[model samples]
Target: MKNANLFVDEAEIEVHSGTGGNGVVRFRREKFVSSGGPNGGDGGRGGDVILVADTNIGTLLDFKSARTIKAPSGAHGGSSNRKGASGEHIEIRVPIGTLVFEVGDTADVVELEESTAIVDLVEDGQRVVVARGGEGGLGNARFKTSTRQAPDFAKPGKPGQSRQLRLSLKLMADVGLVGFPNAGKSTLLRRISAARPRVANYPFTTLVPSLGVVERDDRRIVVADIPGLIEGASDGAGLGHQFLRHVERTRVLIHLLDLEAMIVEGRDLLADYDAIRRELGRYRPELLTRREIVVLSKGDLIHDESVVADLEASLAAREITVRRISAAASLGLDTLLLETFDAVYDARQEEEKRASEEARHHERVGRPGKI
Candidate 1:
């Protein structure tokens, strides 16, 4: 039997807004009135199609089964100058970083910059109406004038049109943890943070990325656990390029090491680390150069700290600063958090500094230049 692939990385969908209600025409009559003026009721406005950012949603798979979205139509005009009922608004639930694009050749569409990872959708409810309903027509009463008494003509309600939009979800996180399968990456995350990612004694227990919030005093950080990568992950091997792209927005990376797995499998832990680096280089070279914290996990498995100490010595010999931690016993967890937070904060400050300098340079040159 073949393995069932349940991953949905990308999807396309269409959204539309509600239409406006139309106006109606009517006449007021009485026993003594010779020619009563036109009194037409206006039509109700059409429902609006709204899109909201939801942090709880992790995937666009919900939109996979439903391809098209629509809003309610405006109610027709009523008699005695009574306006028609407006259409109801339709709210769409989308992942926070979902980007929308107009589907057409040379179509100029709007782009929303996802600068903040933790979007407060509850407070503001960032909403955008994809399509707007047409305006309601004017009633005959609205057209009444001294010269146009008892006008027989009344305006008709306009119809709402449809548009094609493309939605794409981009995973947002403060830090991303990357490594090979069964490298104690999940164990480290579960130990340091409150994220309860599925942990097991086997490989590939995490098929999807998970996130956790780490808080220390008044400071809080979001840590992401990206799925494991294999030898040819860049070219689509073992859950491939799909999961790698999720780490693109992370501020830092934590690479976990399993000392025992390396010694028993006849594999060099450093070499395994290098293999992952090579894959990162192949898939995204920038990822290889990002701020990373190297850690040797399951340190308590060995009899003495010398086993980890020897690995650290070897890494230091290669100019790599390694941090060792035993996730099971919660050893070195606090130090790991302190170092990671400081590193991530420093990296962010440096990035901000560069951005400010670039902006200043652009101001001086009166045009944007390459950074």
Candidate 2:
């Protein structure tokens, strides 16, 4: 069986609203009465096509293939001055973190964040009428109100228009773990959380991103482990390399390094670290700017404590704090988890602080500077 790719957020689809019911022209006549007033009833309004956000959905694969969605049409009016029944509205459920954008626009119109969980339940349930139904036409009974004795004209219902939209989803997580294949990222994740990701003794074991919730003392955080990065991952070398975009939303990054791979490449731990950093810069320079924590995995493999000390000293010389841990042995896991969690939480707070300051600065400026 083929491995499932981690990212499938972006997709395009078309949605159309229902059309209004047609107006009717009729007259009420009895055996004794020769010319009775008009009694035509108005038509009911059409149903609206709406999109809702559902937390249960993780991928956009369903909407990716769907071509179009149409709503129901309203019923026609009756002769006994009875209005037609209105059509039922259609609701579409999408995953959270979905970004809604107009087809031609480069920016997004709506961003559904986890913080908007409450708003999502309310707004997502909301029925946005992309196409409005036409107003109901007046019945012939209205002709009796004025000088016109009999009205023969009635208005027809208007049709609804279609809209094209592009939607994309970005996975939300506190930290993103990145490294080459067989780097023990999955093992580390399994050790930290209850998630049982497939652990194998080969490369590319993880085809898709796996999310795990790490809970400590009632405080929980989410972490995502993505596919291993080959040389040209940014250029789509590996499966779902484009999924790298999802990591952009993370507050911090945990970089895993397998000591064996470094040794095989004829490079030390520091060299392997730089190589991975270079790849991240190539993919997205902004990623390099995120708060990063370096981890040396497979610590148990190093039999000599002196060798571990030497590696730690080498990284420390470069002003990098390297944490050593063996996920398989469950050694130093508690320290790693606590420190990483604290770092991520601090980074998020700092980012929010900087954003608030920037907003205040913009408010003070009020307008663009004359260039």
Candidate 3:
């Protein structure tokens, strides 16, 4: 398990555009005529190296094995004033949330050099040309003037450009399932969505994030079951950045608590919750302000209902209410989905409103009237 199916989200690669073909210089010689005119054709343009955003790709794993990508070269000129065929452009498919970084021109190795953010590919089918192809050269037929009717000179084709690039992927999810390991997040995801993540009663069962779609009444909400977090998660410990960066884009968070484990270990439930909250705040203070839903999971394993009630009362007193549920028993899951969907809708509405306001401000500033 240590070396199998690793999730790669960041990669550095080298790309080169296709080089143009050389022009041809030819003179036509007829069987009966004394002299024939020059009939050399132009060379074809080279191909471009393009990057496209694909919704299906979830990681940058393909770039790990293949680091260098080059386009096809163009065809050379013909004898009868015919233009050569252009090279085919190559498209590199990447994840939708991929961020492209362009390395400096003077840098030889992309890894050791500094790079700047060139594009944020967030939408499906979004495309950008990373390196442009070379221009084709002119043939001897174009140089046939009255002063130099029999000119035998042809321009050489220009060489294509090359670039060094880095790509980083950040998952975009509507709801993020967050908790310590063995908190029944994977179980709940299996019951709610079609994703089949590894399930066990141990720590770090889910090493990578798993995305699933929960659809109800033609409404679909994407949920990401993030990896477990430990004490020093904010400082890159125990799946640190893997957990934090995925949680950044989520509009709502489902925080799961394993009551069965807590009771068996004789640990305080609030202490566990408080520790995670502290880590979240430490990593990003704004994460504490996100819409979080507390859920006491593994309800079926708890034989006594009084333990849940007392814990709920204790949390309610502290202004937090836990949604008691068991994925095995199919308990209290529909309500959680509804609340999460509503929260996602509200978040999207707020974003749209903010965008509209900013657009209006720009429009007003561009106009002649000062308001």
Candidate 4:
């Protein structure tokens, strides 16, 4: 949990619960008692393998080494009709927002697109039993009858269950950071939240998405640092589809454009914005209609401040409001936070309203008098 890998998003794991303890077959032969009745003890129940949604774990990397998770077996029964001790249940901790699917008997790899999720771990401290332990066996004493003076046989414990599971993490975020390579999205994320995503001058510094929680007043807003997108990314070029999958659940998009590129590389600011928009549309058209705030990042690199205003006005002409900020300079970040929080709040209200409406429409159409 301490050194959470910021990269791992999916994994395949196997889980096996413990087998129950065996029952004992013995007869009372103590203190001068002849032909004592059978007194074998029953076995204890086996342990269960539980799955817990832990916020401390950041990714699925925790399961990398623990492919086969197991629980302890119950203790064996003793003589004199003494019951065995039950095994302790074992818990496997995973990050929140993880989706679990049951894999086939012989499948080595998990294909999530073809399978339905068995559980969606969204809340911290949520738990589910992945593998149930075997039942305890009965002792010979339990099998004794009036006709039979004594029973010699004891029942054996049943074997535990084994199954393969697929884990997929879908980032649950209020805001998604999106841009081309080297657009300073990572830098902005660190500037805004405590998430330590890789930041560099090179392209694709953030190979995988990482989450950051931004606390404002009494509310918390989760922001996702989605990996950079490029042209033709929507069609699975350059791990586009993988990156786009994480973006589907975001309510707002913070589209960053590098002002440094505009000044040094003579890159078209409008073109950079358009390229990302096209990729989002191709991946999912709904993503194009999400609430977006365009920000011209790395404003500290530009000597003439008017150039930032000019770029802002250029986008404003197309009815797009923009924010100019430099993460290093700590400029305009507070305003951006306020705006993003407002957008998230509005979207949350709309979501609750729609859910309430659907709740009142649970009745089936053309059944009875319901419409």
Candidate 5:
């Protein structure tokens, strides 16, 4: 069996709406009546293809195998003035924050020159109609008029719509975790929330991003542990490049550092930090300006407090504060959580303020004579 919870962020599929049913031409033949009028019934309408956002679903893995989606066709009309039943609509459930885009003609073409923005599903239970069903045909009875006493012809049903679409899933979280491989990101996530991601003592252990919800004092905050990054990650060197977009919407970022790895590999802590920073800058310049907290993982392995103090001093010299925590030892986790909550709260406040200011500016600009 496949992993049901496997993380899949991107998918491409073909969607087709159901076609309308055909109308029937019939006439009533009674014993007493010489010329019975046309009594044919109208056909039923086709079904539509709808996309619904669901918070329970986390990935697009289900759509990977099922590439084509088709709705049921409508029923044909009956002979004795009986209308056919309409086809049932097909609703596909997807994860929240899923972006749907219309695909171009070519199969391999990922980006289209002129693409239509179908829908951006950001809220749970939100739905969008991707394809419209065909219209039903008119029966022969509808064609009877004063000029034409008995009409035998019936109108054909319109064809349904079909199109190819691309779905991209971006994780929605309040905080994002960023670091190199084996930086204890997975461990930290496990310590903070109930999400138990695959944890091992190796590099690239976490191949996919995992989300965890942290609740404190009736306040809930979602955190995403993004895959580890290496040099040239911005240039698509590792798995981090594939998941970098998931972190773009986070309000805060936690930069986890593996102090034990730096010590074992005889690497400078500042250099490692700078390398990650460079990758973030290369990928997106704005990511560098996002509010971030630096953390040193595996504090239990480091016996010398002076080493941590020196590293903290170096980071402080650059106007960056550092925090240390050991997930295995369950140390400093409470303080980390509290501090993270504070940072998240501040970031949210700032974002709300900026949005309010922008709304006011737009209102002022649109008023009266100000073009």
Candidate 6:
């Protein structure tokens, strides 16, 4: 509960678009002529409900208390061929990586059913219309013909669309830092980026995921420090289920290990690593396949370099090379950042290549063939 603000990722709200304005029936009046023709104008269209993605906002905290969002209705048409004013659109700002789901059966008396995926707002300034406004009805003047002398009736405007929407936010980052509690992940994040996450010596100091932007060689890499994981994390132990989902979108993971804790607390380094891996595999098998960089933190606590070398050698046997770094002393940090950035850049290139190949394959498969 320390970082409660970061966990407000889900919200459900109802949105209603503006109704169209009604057209009025009027006749043009002249100063000299006794008879005048119909001059009534058409009504204006209604407003739309739109969702905008904003990078500044990190969570859906704003929508937690908001139950319903309504747009302003269009103004009614006036006499003498004066058109009605269009309704103002209602815009809602959400996090950049928000996923919008359209809820079905939103009646007050009935229970809501499963929601359908509408759209994913991933980039800044991206927007999507959730509900459309009702159309305006035609005026009586439009129905008037040469045979008809005067029309007295006018059409009303149609109602706007209304529906319930669910907004779910998933943090998007190039690197994700994962570890047990008090593994110096928060300290490392603060040392590398401008993010000021609350760091303490106790366990579970970071209850929520914290994001920071690291700049290297004129390039920016966003890193997310997820909360610690314990045994049985996949089964919701120690609120691990809430934190693990944030790591799914990361391109690379920095698996931090506490060298000091291994010695002081008498914890085995390999066991700690495997336990976290098991949880990740159980929660999502794909997470196990992600590229991970093992990091042994708190090098300042250990005086002898052999201790660090021994641990590195042990992990190397399992095909995992460990990077030794001390956040307090700022030792080996520059190398760690450079290596992490390189991994992220390489992963991005591979992803783009795969996507291009898939697109070409689809195009070839969908092309016309001779009979």
Q: Give the top-scoring candidate (TM-score).
A: 6
Listing every candidate in turn, what is its Cα RMSD in Å to the true structure after a full C-alpha superposition?
5.2, 5.4, 4.1, 4.1, 3.4, 4.1
lDDT tens digits, residues 1-371, model 4? 35433467888899899888888898988788877888889888889998898888778886777789888777777789987787789998988888988888645553465236778888899999988988778788888899877999898777787888988888778899999889998898898789888888888777888889999898789999888898889876765768777877899999999888899888988998999999999878999999999998987887876766777778889998887888999999999999999999999999999987776666434334521
lDDT of 6 by residue, 221-260 (tens): 9999888898998888886667787888899999989998
> Model 3: how far is 251 from its true place, Å?
1.8
Error of 2 at 212 (Å): 1.7
Q: Measured by TM-score, how close is model 2 to the native structure? A: 0.81
TM-score for each predicted model, relative to the true structure: 0.84, 0.81, 0.89, 0.86, 0.90, 0.91
lDDT of each: 0.75, 0.73, 0.83, 0.84, 0.85, 0.84
Candidate 2 or 5, higher lDDT? 5
Model 1 TM-score?
Answer: 0.84
* Residue range 1-371, candidate 5, lDDT tens digits: 44634889889889999888777788888999997989888888889999999989899998989999998777777777777788789999999878888877555764322124567788899999999888878888888899987889876666788999999888889999999999999999998899888889888888888899999997789999888999999888977477888888788899988898867986678888999999988877888998898898999998877766777788889988788899999888889899999989998899899999988997988744621
Q: Lowest summed-lDDT stretch of 10 residues in model 6?
A: 107-116
Clashing residue pairs for model 4: none
**Model 2 clash pairs?**
6-208, 6-209, 38-141
- Measured on C-alpha atoms, candidate 2 has an lDDT of 0.73
Instruction: Write down the worst ten-residue block by lDDT for model 1.
Output: 115-124
lDDT of 3 by residue, 165-221 (tens): 888777788888988888889999999999888898788999888788899997888
Scored by lDDT, the top model is 5
Q: Look at candidate 6 and give me any clashing residue pairs.
A: none
Off by over 4 Å in 3: 1-4, 105-116, 145-148, 366-371
lDDT of 1 by residue, 46-155 (tens): 77777787776666777889888888877767768888887887888876656666567644433323342123232225767777776667777778889988787777
What's the candidate order when arranged by decreasing TM-score? 6, 5, 3, 4, 1, 2
